[model samples]
Target: MKLISTSNYEKLSQQAGEEIISRIKRNPTLNLGLATGSTPTGLYQELIKDHKQHKTSYKEINTFNLDEYIGISKKDRNSYHYFMCEHLFEHIDIPLDQTHIPDGTAKDLDEECSRYEQFINEHGGIDLQILGIGQNGHIGFNEPGTPFDSRTHIIDLAESTRKANSRFFESLDDVPKQAITMGIASIMDSKEIFLLVSGASKAKALATLMNGDVREDFPASALKNHGNVTIFADKDATALL
Candidate 1:
């Protein structure tokens, strides 16, 4: 694992964007693992700007989002699918079919999970993965204490996660307590991983992860064992490190 202290949020976003740019430049069809939430919003904006200014088109890039709120319709404002297009896809050149976000309203959730994994497997796994850590060390909604051996599945949102995510909803009850997320096993399969962390609230989690041993209690700790994971942090987020 490599630790990168970014100058600021903009720099962090660019670093993350450059990761995808490098991969896209190397192979237009690079399979990308993506994350949602405020942390990655800046990175998405940067990619869109790069596409406009530098013509870094995503015409053939294959993207697989990390997670989505269960039971939320794709048209819902808070859905990951909605977030992707509103933030990045609509402004870029990525083919609609090349982007994959788990359908939140699937009638058979199990079948949806299976197909998602299969789709990724047939694509030769993710070439580059971008992640944003939950305040409790969760990644892709695989909350704290999630088994490292687990696979893609439906999971109840942790209280803290729900509370943190509630900002997007009008009320706490409006926040879906369940979500479908890509498992750590699949995330670990990526050839390269970039873990982007920011905000003062994330300080404790970041510090704990940087200081703690590799344990199941804090799922993000598992990244320490991955050979190609890079962690980028703003000064406040890395203060405890």
Candidate 2:
């Protein structure tokens, strides 16, 4: 595990973007794992800017998103599918067919989870995965107490998570109660992991991740067991560290 602290969110995003862009250039066929939420929006913007300014091609890139709300339609504005499209997919040169996100509305969600896991295995797993630590240390909706060895599966969103996400919806009740997320084991399969932590709200979580023991109670701590994980955090997020 490596920690790179920056003065602010923009600087962290820029550094992360440059690294990702360099990786894409070196391996155009990179299997990229993506994350949603406010933390990564700046990084996505940086990618978009570079794609336009330097013509960094994503044409051969294959992207797999982290999670999606279980009860939302893909077209729903609140859905992770729509979030990815709006924030990154629509702006990139990557083929839509090559970008994979779990079907949240699948009739049999368990089957969908299994299929998605199989699909990732077929692609040789993710070369690099982007992650954002939740205020409660969740990763990809794998909330606190999620088993570290778990595979792709459905999870009941923690109440705190729902409350935090309420800002994106009209009300707390509008947030989905459950989601399908790539499990900790699935995430650990990635060749490398890029974790982004910003804002004072996440300072305690980041501190715990940096100094606490490995345990299921803090999902993000699972990364500590991985050989290749880099954390790009801003000063605010690292204050407690």
Candidate 3:
């Protein structure tokens, strides 16, 4: 529940990226968890810059993305897989084979969900997890009512989430109805967590998650129980808080 605000998004992004780089340097083979959203776009850009400057190397790191829209192809512009490659994976030195993103087109989603969580456990769980809060306080697509102890699973997107995410879609109708995401338990298992938020649009959710009660109605509130968590936000995002 710790909060750190910066004068602007760029500096916040850089600081957060530096912290991640330090962790990776401490352990070249760190198991990292990733989140995708407009909030983290700047952070990814800074990481790209770090790689170009030779300040960071992702050669042996392993990444597990938090969620993916179900029923979408990896080639889809709005897919998390596509977004990750466009923003960070493509610019970094991490091998594609070392990254793990949930399959959006799996025929048996239940099996896919089970396997995804199992794979995480086998890989030593996530050492660091990056998260972005939805407008309604959802994290990793685990919208309100998602049990705090749950693991990976399929879920319907809340209306607030759909509206917030629709900016990347042709229309609200084009947004997928469902997604597969790591649950609250899975996220809490991470040794460290970094929650990034930027922009005025996220101010309300950021405020709520930071000061609100620990309840399922605000899914991100569940994060308070984690022993090591850092929340980084730009002024705009921290305005409400």
Top-lDDT candidate index = 2
- The deviation in Å at residue 217 for candidate 2 is 0.4
Q: Rank the candidate models, highest lDDT first.
A: 2, 3, 1
User: Cα deviation in Å at residue 220, candidate 2?
Assistant: 0.7
- Candidate 2, residue 122: lDDT: 99
lDDT of 1 by residue, 120-142 (tens): 99989998899999999999999
Single out the weakest 10-residue window by summed lDDT for candidate 3: 50-59
Q: What is the TM-score of each candidate against the true structure?
A: 0.98, 0.99, 0.97
RMSD of each predicted structure: 0.9, 0.5, 1.0
In Å, residue 229's CA in model 2 sits off its true spot by: 0.6
Instruction: List runs of model 3 lying over 4 Å from the truth.
Output: none
- Candidate 1: residue 89 lDDT (0-100): 89
Better of 2 and 3 by TM-score: 2
Report the lDDT tens digits of candidate 2 across residue range 1-241: 9999999999999999999999999999999999999999999999999999999999999999999999899899999999999999999898999999999999999999999999999999999999998999999999999999999999999999999999999999999999999999999999999999999999999999999999999999999999999999999998998
Instruction: Write the number of the candidate with greater lDDT, choosing between 1 and 3.
Output: 3
Best by TM-score: 2
Question: Which lDDT value does model 3 have at 74?
Answer: 95
Better of 1 and 2 by TM-score: 2
